[model samples]
Every structure is written in C-alpha cells, then in structure tokens.
Target chain A: MITVALPKGSLLKDTIRMLQGAGLDFSGFLDSSNRQLQIVESSGRAQGLLVRAQDVPVYVEYGQAQLGIVGYDVLYEKEPNVAQLADLGFGSCRFSVATKKDGPYRSALDLPPHCRVASKFVHSARRYFQSIDLPVEIIPLSGSVELGPITGMSEAIVDLVSTGRTLKENNLMELEVLFESTARLVAHPLSYRLNVDNLSEYVDLIRQQVLVVA
Target chain B: MITVALPKGSLLKDTIRMLQGAGLDFSGFLDSSNRQLQIVESSGRAQGLLVRAQDVPVYVEYGQAQLGIVGYDVLYEKEPNVAQLADLGFGSCRFSVATKKDGPYRSALDLPPHCRVASKFVHSARRYFQSIDLPVEIIPLSGSVELGPITGMSEAIVDLVSTGRTLKENNLMELEVLFESTARLVAHPLSYRLNVDNLSEYVDLIRQQVLVVA
Candidate 1:
C-alpha cells in the first residue's frame, strides 16, 4: 500500500481532488469535522495521512509515507532529505523582505549591515542575505513577523506574503521578493528507488495530472 | 506609560482578568471581534499589545513593550534577555518525551544513541539529552510533534502536553516529563532596572495579585 502525506489548510481540497482524478480516493478528508488524521481508502490500495503543511516532507523523508504534497516555501525552510518530484503549481505565494511603510529603507540593500531582520523563514532569509553578501541578524519569529517592524525589534521582515493584506494592514510594505512558491510533489528516496508497491506508477500518474493542472 | 505585551490563546482570558484585578482596565480586548492589536487602556496610563505567545519576549527585549506575559516553555526556548519577574501560575502544562504507546523503549534512556527525536522544543531537548550524556538527533518540528512516532519519522518526540487528549488520541505515551510550564511575567532588563514608566510599581502590583490568587 502507498501511504501519502497530505497537508492541512489552504490547497487541501485541490490536492484531494487531484488525487481523486488519479483514481486514489481520499475524499473523506474533505469533511470539516472529521478528526481522523489517518484515513484508509475503501479499496485499501492507498492510505492518507493528514498533517500540518510544514510536516509533509518530514513524513515522506522518513518513509512513513511514500509520497507527500507540500509547498516550496516549506521545502526551502526544512530542506528535508527527500526527492523533489514535480511542481503541482497551486498555493502560489511569494517570499518577500518587508519594512515599515514609513521607514527610510526602500530596498533590501539599503538596510544597514547587521541590522535585525525578523522572519519565521530564517533559513531562506539567511540564504537570501548571504547570496547578496549582506550580513544581517535574522530573528526567528514563529508567528506575526509583521510585528518585527512595528515593534521596532527589527528593521525588516522576511516572510511569506500570501495576499499582501496582512502586510498592508500592519502598515508594512514589501521591499523585495525572494521567490515564488507553489505546491510540489516529494517522495522518500529509498521508497522511490526500491519502487515499493508500484510507487513509480503512482508518481507518474501524479506527474501527468500536475501537467494537466498547469 | 507602560506598554504591555499579552499573549493570545488559551491563557489570554485569564491574563486579562488578572490585569483587571490589578486595577488596569483593558476589557476592550475581550470583545471577540476586536481587530486591534494594540489597545490603550481606558485611563491611558497603560497600553496592551496582543501578540503571539512566542513573540512576547522579543517585543519586551527590544523595549517595544516594557513588559510581557508568556509561557515558561517559550522562555526556555527563546531565552530572551529579559527579567523573569514572577510566575503568573496559570496556563499550566508539561514538556515531555513521548513515543507510540506500543513502542519498544519505555524510557528516554532506553533509546539508542544518536536515535532520531523530533520536537518543537529543540533547545530544551538538546540540553536534556546533553545533561544526561545521551546523544540524539533532535529534529525541530514546527507543529504536530506527535506525528513523529506515528509516521515513524523519529523514535520519539518532545512537545507540550496540556490535557494529554491529543497524545492519547494519537496513541502516544509520555516517556518522561522534562518540566512543568506556566505563564510568567517578564520585563525588558533595562526597563525593570531603570523603572521605566514606573514599571516596577506595576510589576509589584501584579506580583501581589498573583500571591493573592495563590
């Protein structure tokens, strides 16, 4: 049996629908009140594990689930040892460097070296700053990176900007975007290599469906 | 005037009640639909900033908020430069080492050296293992640490357990508890030292109220 790790929250419906299109039924997850984290399909050919969006790769990496669907942003942050399969092209968002709307700095380069930049996406923020040869303190905030600028705890913030509304409501402006993010398919390397339970066939099915989605 | 950072979540109502008992009115925050992040008290002598439970200290450490109330677990993880004035004594929970109820090992010591462990509280996990001279790979999971053992991603997990329902539902058993956690009163070091905005007086008032509650 192939166990698939699916993320919770936005994009969940699409993922389930996509899988349904591939003939693997996990539609039970669509029920809002369903508390079951692990659900087995009626056919027992494949099972589903519902988990936090950030945890998709971890499950797949450990081979608990042969496959997972998660965001590119999570991929950048966790950097789990898993095979990146195909881009599913949904959950489109972008990473950006932002500062107080009234702040003097208009760009990432304008911030003084060693200035504090708060972000939950610390790894990605560090990589971006390092790539540009900018030395800045990356303060990791699990929630509300927007508060970093408002509280004067940091000069700027690096975080996912989904709708731009959260940033605008906080009186912050996007200074620079790091990258566009989309959901991608990932699988356990060993499982893929061993072709456990016709894993390659299911992978190919999803890949073709993803192309259809694009 | 003193700016206070109050955490949002399970203990928020109690924290506000405690503050009201100290004769500082911030009842506006009680409105379920209130959209304001920062609210000035009716008397204007104190203002409240509703922030993520984890970011409480960052605001205080940077002097944005003169004082903050946060979970002790967060204090242990962040270790921000702030004065731990008092323990408010509510929002009680525990940090524990847990695994699938049917797992082979019965205790933390029973786990093999360098065995994989997942946790949101990575620092505390590292410290606990190091103190006991047991080496383990601590994976930092942002959410749902219980999934660690279930998905076979790790041998064990370290996370907060409140009512233990979540763990029970997931069929995980607590192997060992590291420490009990409660909400704490904290202040910026300089603010407490310099008595900024008569911070010490308010701190003392709250401390007295806390003692009365005890």
Candidate 2:
C-alpha cells in the first residue's frame, strides 16, 4: 500500500480535504478522538502518517512515505532531498524580518552590524542576510520568535507572518519580506523516479485536484 | 521589575504554584482565556514571559529574563550558557532508547553500527551513543518522534518517556534509559552574579520554598 505523510497542524484540514478530493479518505486523522498517528484510508489503497510540518519532508526523504504535504518554508529551511511534485497552493504565508515598531530600525538594512535577529528559520535568515551583504547574528529559537523583540533579547526577528496580527499585537512590524510560502506536494526522489507502488498515479490525481482548487 | 520566563506547557502549572509559594502570583498564565504571552502579577513587582520550554533558557541567557524555569532535558540538549540555579523537582521524566516490541534489538548495544536513531534531543542522544562507544545516525525530528520507529524511519527512538503509555500504545518498548530529567530553575549568569533587581532575593525565596515542598 502507498503511504502519504500529512502535516499535523494548520495545514491538516486542507490537506485532508485535498486527499479526499483525490479519492483517498484519510479523514480519520482529523478526528479529535482518533489518536493514531498512522491511519489507513477507507479503501485501504493508501495510508496517512500524521506528522509535524517540519517532519513531513524527513519521512518522504527517508522513503518511509512515498509522498508528503508540507509548507514551502519548511522545505526551504530543511533543504531535504525530496522531489517537488506540485504546489498545493493553500497555507499561504511569508518569511519577514520584524522588529519593535518603536525601535530605531525601519528596514532590514537599517539595523547595525552584528545585531541579533531571532528566528526558527535560522538558515533562511542567514541566507537572507548574506544575500543582502549584512552581518547579523541569527538566534535560533524554536517558538515565539515575536518574543525576541518584546523581551529585548534580540534587536529583530525573522519569522513567518501569516495575518500580521501576531506581529501587530506584539508591537512588531515587518521590515522586509524574504519570501512567500505555500503548502507544496513533495515525494521521495527515488520513489518518484521509479514510480514505486504506482505513486505517479496518486501524484497525478492529487495534482489535478489541487489545480482545480487553485 | 524582575522578569521571569515561564515555560508554556506541562511545567507551567507547577512553576506558577512554586512562584506563588515564593509570594509571586503569576497564576494568570494558567487561565485559558488569557491570550497574553506576557503577564504581570497583581502588584506588578514582577512580570512573566510565557514561552516554549526550549526557549526559556534563551530568554534568560540573553538577560531578557533574569530567571526562568525549564526542563533538564532541554538544557541537556541545547547546552545553553546559563547558570542552573535550582532543581524545581517537578515535571519528572526520562530519556530512553525504544524500539518496536517485536524487533530483533533488545538493547541499544544490540543495534547494528550506523543504525538510524531518531530524537528531538539529538545532542543528548549523540553524547549517550558516544559514551557507550556506539555509532548511530541520529535523525533530528521536531515533534511526534514516536512515529519514527513506527514508520520504519529509524531503528530506535531516543525520547522522553513519562508514563510509557505512548510507547506501549505504539507497540514499542524501552530498551535503555539514558537519563532522568526534571524541571529546573535557571538564571542568567551575569544577572545572578550582579544580583540585578535583587535577583538573588527572589532566587533564594523560590529555592527555600522548593526545598520545603521537596
């Protein structure tokens, strides 16, 4: 049986709906009472592994799951060896540099050299700074990058901004947009190339549905 | 005002209770309706920044928070440059190497060389395997590590086992215990040394109360 790795939060509902549209019913993962991480679809042709968004590519890269649904931000940060099959187009967001609204800085380049910028996406933040020829320390924080500016731990933060509400509520403003991100369909490179378990058939069906929705 | 970094999940309740015992009432953090990540006590002598357990040390080490509460597991993994002040003696758990119950390996040593082991605590796992003179590829996963062995992604998983319920339910068995962990009180080294905002006074009060409860 073919296996699909599904992200657990934020993107899960849309992912489940997309899978259903593709003739796979792994909706049991959406049930609050169903605690199982691995669930087989109604027809048992495909199974779903409910995992973290960051972990989606890992499962697919390791060949544990032939296909995965993950965010572009995670793929950019992790740089896992996986085939980019399709852009599912939901879960739109962006990586941006944010700082205290009342702080001196108005743009990414306005900050002084070596000023710390906290972020969960350290690699992406580093690359962005390097591309701009600016020197800044990227503090790797697992969660709540907005707190970096609020707590005075860092001069700025590089984080995903969804609605701008979180940054506004925390008295932070986006100084620069590094990149736009949306959920994408990914598959194991070898599996996709070899068409393991007729994976291309499922991939084609999912792609068709995603295109219709987009 | 003294700023204390309080962890957001699992340890928050006990940490708040401990602080209350020390005459700081920051229990507002526990109120589900309170959406604030940072809250001030009624008297406002101190404020709390609620953050992820791993980020607690980051806040404190950067001197944004003079004091913080976090799990020893995180400290062991991150190895942040903070002074471990006191063991709060709560949120007890252990790091263990676990594998499928029906798998051939019965112990960590039984696993083949260069076998894959998955964990959120990659540093701790690496240190353990090194100390044991074993070579294993440690896959760092952000969440739901129990799915590692279940999905055939890893030969074993190094994860915290509290009640062993998660592992048991997933048909895995703990083969070896790496270490025991509990909540710990930490302080910024410079802040503690300088006694900024009379930080020692609060630290002493909390330590004394923890001793009484322990």
**Best of the candidates, DockQ:** 2
Stretch of 10 with least lDDT, candidate 1 chain B: B139-148
Model 1 agreement with the true structure over B130-214: per-residue lDDT tens digits: 9889999997777878877876789999899999999999999999999999999999999899998898889988998899999
TM-score of 2: 0.98
Candidate 2 residue lDDT tens string, A1-214: 8899999899999999998999999889877899888988889788999999999998999999999999999999989999998999999998899999999988899999999999999999999999999999998898988888887789999999999999988889999999899999999999999999999999999999987996
TM-score of each: 0.95, 0.98
Indicate which candidate wins on TM-score: 2
* DockQ for the candidates, in order: 0.65, 0.83
Q: Which stretches of candidate 2 lie over 4 Å from their true place?
A: none
Candidate 1 Cα misplacement greater than 4 A, ranges? none
